[model samples]
Target chain A: MCTYRTTTLTVAGSGKGAEGWFPVTDASVYFDHPVHAPADHTLNVDLRNPSRGASARVAVELDPVSARALALAILDMLDSAPAGLVDAATPSGVPPAG
Target chain B: MTPGDLTAETVTITGHGGDAVEAYLAQPLAGPPAGGVVVIHHMPGYDAGTKEIVRKFAANGYPAIMPNLYFREAPGASPDDAAAVARAAGGVPDERLVGDVAGALGHLRALPGSNGKVATIGYCSGGRQSFLAACSLDLDAAVDCYGAFVLTAPPDEFPLQVGPLGHLVGDLSCPMLGLFGADDKYPGPEEVAEFEAALGRAGKDVEFHSYEGAGHAFFNTDRPSFRPEAANDGWERIWEFFGRHLSA
Candidate 1:
């Protein structure tokens, strides 16, 4: 079996994008723990597909698999959740972590 | 017809050495056979849970057979004593399992309601065995559920007694569909990848899926770890595969 190092990302920031979040390729990863995302923090970047160098902040809530994939892609970043985030965890489309 | 609509009979079939294997034969209550499906039980040996699985297939319009792999236990032993039954069966010597399953397939073909074509579906240990059946038995198709340790053994054990699937690589004569839980401990993503590569190397066709958030025994709804989403999706895939391969 291949060994995969587990990495955690703290939500730093939140936002909307021209297009909505694409679960398979978005920046967010999913986890079982809610601590993976903090609520009420607006994303400063785009949550949907970003033009090269463009950024947004959207809420990110990922299922366990999506979270893992996102975590693997961005190993050490944090994003803050937007206000009134009523879900168990944040959804992806949140802005990138600063 | 659904499982509730089947006319199932409980019967005992004698194995190579007077070893008796229990089985449930379910036929459609209203019509002719849609197809023949042989359901293999997981490592713990056949029990009420396995019987229920057979009924599920029967309800789908196929005549399903659930075989008791542990011949050591008398046919119809109390389902409560599963562990004892497995122990009595002496751990299913690897070499014998394939032949035994083939024997079961032969039995199914001869049944009155059955068509000559067959598909075998198995979980866990049965999953590994199902692969072997696909390789060795002249079946139309096979569905393997999270059967770990398939073709990933060390070089020294190149020929595993259980199925010897690795050795049977170039000789694989049938097509198979494999469903695995991405997070399963035994046959995790890495193992599935390697198995896929091996099949590719041997020039075999496979339809494989590794569902995220799903783990071992994902299809076993009665178990605590069952992943309903993955299981349902996998069942649809299996049904399509069987329909394509075993169709009249």
Candidate 2:
């Protein structure tokens, strides 16, 4: 089944793609058929630069459980960092774009 | 061009508001004035598997073409990347899809060997699009391979650009063949029955088969969802359906 469920957002970050590091202005998260994964469906993310060709993307397809775990791990890693280490880039009251 | 010899190539054709779009064209070696088919690729985009389907049509003596629905969004990029871009762009608009199909039909008819007959077959998301094209155009035949969202709407959170097309049943211009899996949820047995009832009420010529123990995407050979038993029988049904309507 084509899940067609998608969430897209604009982000400010640098992602290393096939060519190298490029500024990624867009992110798309969807649970649907994977391009390369062996499973029928996956939680997939694409960090991309629309100005660049579509090839300018870093993508990952993870199963639902792994995707949830990865999300928690990301929060955990951020929380464990020294106070203000990650927040130095952005002042309080402004949430991270991604 | 010999009838049995076949070749496939990428070409450019006018599409969707006269845009020059990349497309795959496969033709038998010699122009045998044969019928044509337009294959609409699944949501995975115009990838390798879809190309193989176009080639298979040519080998079976039908000239076929598949317009790269994502060419405008991600030209020269990989199929997966292009698909991502297209998906982020809110999927293909219904008007654009109709225009692309019309362009492909024109290209096929211009062939020296065209028999002036055309049919369409689409899998997954393309399945619903195939029905849309058949309803919107003067097509002779159409095959819907487990197309969802034709009779039911996706959850509101999904915001899929498509909507239920039950209202269009009155406009269908051709005979239709639907192949489905009994276990598929998107257009499970209940939805399929609703679609059939609509077709019946419209007094349209249609045939549908729902396989037992099979689920969504049962025809996708690459995915784990592939069910050989269902796919084989589905293919046989497709050939027979096309043979009846596509032949001169």
Top-lDDT candidate index: 2
TM-score of each: 0.65, 0.95
Q: What DockQ does each prediction reach against the true complex?
A: 0.01, 0.67
Docking class of 2: medium
Q: Supply every candidate's count of residue pairs whose N, Cα or C atoms clash at under 3 angstroms.
A: 44, 4
lDDT of 1 at B142: 84
Q: Residue B154's C-alpha lDDT in candidate 2?
A: 65
lDDT of 1: 0.63
lDDT of 1 by residue, B1-248 (tens): 44458778877765545456667787777666566888888754676677878887777777788777764443344442332333322346555666667666777788776768888988877888788777777888888888866765422222223333578767666788999989886687887888888888878888899999888777765655678999899989987898888777
lDDT of each model, Cα atoms only? 0.63, 0.90
Q: What is the TM-score of chain B alone in each candidate?
A: 0.88, 0.96
* lDDT of model 1, residue B79: 42
lDDT of 2 by residue, A1-98 (tens): 78788999888868999999998889999999998899989999999999988999999999999999999999998899878668765543234565
lDDT minimum window of 10 residues, candidate 1 chain B: B154-163
